[model samples]
Target: MHTPIEGFSKLTKAEKIDWLSENCTTDAEKTKQLLKRYWNANSSVQKIHDEFIENTVSNYYLPFAIAPNFLINNALYAIPMAIEESSVVAAASKAAKFWLDKGGFKTTVLGTEKVGQVHFMYTGNKKKLLQFFETIKASFFEDTKAITQNMKKRGGGIKDLELRDKTDKLANYYQLHCTFETLDAMGANFINSCLEQFSKTLQKEADVYFDFSADEKQLEVVMSILSNYVPNCIVKAEVSCKIKELDEDELSGQKFAEKMLQAIDIAKAETYRAVTHNKGIMNGIDAVVLATGNDFRAVEAGIHAYASKTGEYSSLTHAEIKDGVFRFWIEIPLALGTVGGLTSLHPLVKLSLEILQKPNAEELMQIVAVAGLAQNFAALRSLVTTGIQKGHMKMHLLNMLNQLGATEQEKQQLVAHFKDNAVTNASVKEALEKIQTH
Candidate 1:
């Protein structure tokens, strides 16, 4: 039997939660924890203090919304995201709806484990340093073995190792890159700790005129710091459908795909265009990263770094029309989490998770990657056809009227007037007074 879908605004909070739980394999306990984190028994002094620091005074709060009509891996899901940008949620929902109307988004994730990089600098011969690290590679693995002992017991570990040497811009300094897998957790702390512990042994074993520091607090021996950039590693997914419904020209998915690919190519060619191009991608990725309490800043850094890894800034996603079907594919560094930190602590975050039904790490990554691809298409479609500012300015006009203290009716009238007269504060004021008196 076919069931009617309810509009998001029509569903109550509890109904929404119930719908999510019924559709996905949500952890009830985690759902409860999320509610408690966002909703308090009493507005206590401590609660106010925490809110002040984490929210209002500190500007930590972010709005979250559920992108509707996602069908991933043959299952229906209302993907949850935390973001501030307009049109992103709407565009994702629209793209997903279009796919759902055809069939649905098909997705696959590599694994649950995430990798973190540890870098070392050398002033000695690059080839010799590489050979030395290779010689003691097993020992280095053993030293960091305890860090992931539990994960190893569960059959996971440092999956690979990579080393790269490049001359600094000044030509006097040498940069050495060491890449290692941290299994799960953001692993920043663990990766840095392992590098610090290994540096002492590395310096003594190899005759390298180098000093390194990962002491967290000190910056003495540090040339540059942090292991936030993730390279080469990719998380990917695709959505495709037959073009049976729409005519070849009116709303052909194939044409849409071609236009999208062209926009991405143009974005790659210019630095200015690449900024907005990447921003559109981040609009989707960062939301999920924040909702899950993953370090979104790190994810952003890694994404941009990976984008430019080929020496040219480019779109992380690609779309096409192949074999009479519309297809979209994306492979980007999505370092996100399902557990730990404020994910378990924050109240609204908990609510957002409940609304999402708490997908596991791999499932979550797949959904986020899909959302990113959808958002990319949305932006490209707008840029290629209607112009980005048209829809955006329309939405902004409503917000502007509301901010001006216009009543609901007055705001509606103001929007109508602004559409004809152009959106300006002076025009808004004139419309406001005309609507107020008449």
Candidate 2:
């Protein structure tokens, strides 16, 4: 993949499409088929009627432009995100530009290890099962090691094991929590396989029939299928930039920082506000996750659960100003993928990965972390400076213009007019009439 054009805004729609095609691999036929699937139209019929013909699916593909000018950890990156929401890309680009003008975004990613858990439940006496696990802990772990020999060789292995018991007068059950450090891989498939094998070994050793699947319907008590709670492997980064413009506005960096902190505080204090607050961060993360074909739903669930882990829903990121510079930081559970599964299936997902130059899973995670932080900054800046509606409503008006069937020139005039006057159906109708008369 090559660098984007210097002034992409100057190009026509066709030119932009052509430029993207040249810089990155494009399967026009596949894209058309996907769009057709989205439109719920037969590919054969649409091929004859529509300029862009393909199969119909349940979802439509809409492209938004991801602008450049980001300096992350002293490196320049052109982050291209695919999303349908308005202002996300533009807001991120603006935030990145702000950082670049000051200094740059300084970032540091921790390790490349992800945690996977295998849960086990015992149907036998809870005390007996607990004692059995304690007695054979070393042997069981050794067997686990044998299964994950390759991973151990790569400096990753079963890190720890713990037991939790729930007992009452009627019944008792114990849980075996096995934690593994999966290095640079999603590791769910591998971890599950290892757990299945270990479960058999435990059953054989104890001479007890362990009901791996406990039916909650029949028995008043049951065991967990598996807990998706990620291990405490934290990823952290900090971005600091000197805001000379804030000084010019008679706003000391300290005051600006206080304002930003207040906004963040407000976001954390209310679930209503925190929902949109986190959505901004997801705007950046989901795009990258979608492009890589990872399970965005799993990531979302883990992140939201993490956000409320403290018993109060709050923002995962924080911002402040110190010593005439703005500083922002975020730490979140961003379990994502760079390769395997749908990343290898769909053509466009593969193409987006190619444009990213095939970053390893760790690098992909780092970039995702940066995007989340940038998106957070965008949201706060808008809330503090010009209202968020200015940019959001502007993009929305363009979408309305598309629905009105205004020609390119008419669209330009209508956009300019709407900027000065409030937008209404009557205003749109008047513009349409003028276009027809002309």
Candidate 3:
């Protein structure tokens, strides 16, 4: 059995790798070789990657791709996506091209407010607590004045503060709910710094409040942090055209519009369908989010929370065909920043932002929204017409072949064969076996 080790982080990179390979692998030298093979050719670049995270392991890579012909708000853009999935970029590009002649995507930033909270417990009189909060609310801002100085200069700072009583739900539980406008930065650190200060002030003030009883004076700060549920930081992206113009090669315009609307209705009504439907939207959203070096996980959490905001889980993308026109759109909460965190530090992130024409926070929000809206449009179109697997499986073919250890000639032959044949695991295996036999 392997034993736990201490002071592992104190070891040098080479020593760490050596220890890990020996203790964790069946073939130590091969493990080292595989890890080293992924290192950047330039030592300086490799060193940068090493410092990106702890453990100092070799770099893990994902494909960086571009989807061209995106015309958003009367501007053309070639959006960059970094993802391991194969069909996402292709689908997004296809949708963008489809909408190019139909007035492309139009987007608007709905709001740019974010949220944070300070939770505490005080077994005090509710009315007295409320009065105390009204008196000290100004101090919350005053305490964090230095921290919010730069954000204020940028026209973004504390928006509001409220004292929420949750004593009925959890005894003596209360929250100092706050709202903020961070402008070009995600402002997580700034919001959190301000919240921590507010928490300290709340405890300190409660300790000496004249009206508080001895028990009420016992204010316990639970936690102070930024919330991932940002309903106010929202953006909307949409595409619309005459229903008669919805024509593709095989499907009639009216038929296509009707079928697309029906598919969306089913997705909105059924929970199972809605989950996958929203996931398809996120495929495009997350690709761009990851490429830009923003927190995709935070974006994902906030978006899904927004999806269920209406009491039931449902589709994020909505479709409607009326007045001889077909309209599809999505409005999602996205707290994105274009000027901070890894946006300036990561080389690829900087390049991705540059490719996006150096958009501000609101512009980036619109762009990301367009990506998601385009992706869902492509997915629904395929589902209502030729079906989804045809494109998805075709994109997946190369990965299947690579996994089988097929040579160049075999991959070429199999690629051609699968073009006319159905793609499935058993069929692929059989085709490869037959090719090898010959």
Top TM-score prediction, candidate number: 3
How well is each residue in 324-409 modelled by candidate 2, as lDDT tens digits? Answer: 66677888776666655666656566777676667666677777777888888888877776667766777677777788777898
Q: What's each prediction's TM-score?
A: 0.74, 0.76, 0.97
lDDT of 1: 0.65
Residue-wise C-alpha lDDT for candidate 3, range 230-297, written one tens digit per residue: 99999999999998898888898999988888998998899999999999999999999999989999
Model with the higher lDDT, candidate 1 or 3: 3
Span of 10 residues, lowest total lDDT, candidate 1 = 215-224
A best-first ranking of the candidates according to their TM-score comes to 3, 2, 1
> Stretches of candidate 1 above 4 Å error?
1-59, 110-135, 160-164, 167-178, 204-226, 243-258, 412-430
For model 2 the local lDDT of residue 242 reads 67
What's the best-to-worst order under lDDT? 3, 2, 1
lDDT comparing candidate 3 with the true structure: 0.91
Candidate 1 per-residue C-alpha lDDT over 1-438 given as tens digits, one digit per residue, 9 for 90 to 100: 325566844665555555554554367556545644664446663364344332221123467788888888778888778887767788888778867866676777654444444444445556666666678766667776677677567555556555544445533233334454444455566556656655654545553423333432111123323356655446787876664543334346556557766776787688788877888888888887777677888888888888888888877877666687766778877666556656676766667667667766566678878888888777776777777876666667766777778788777666676675655567667778777777
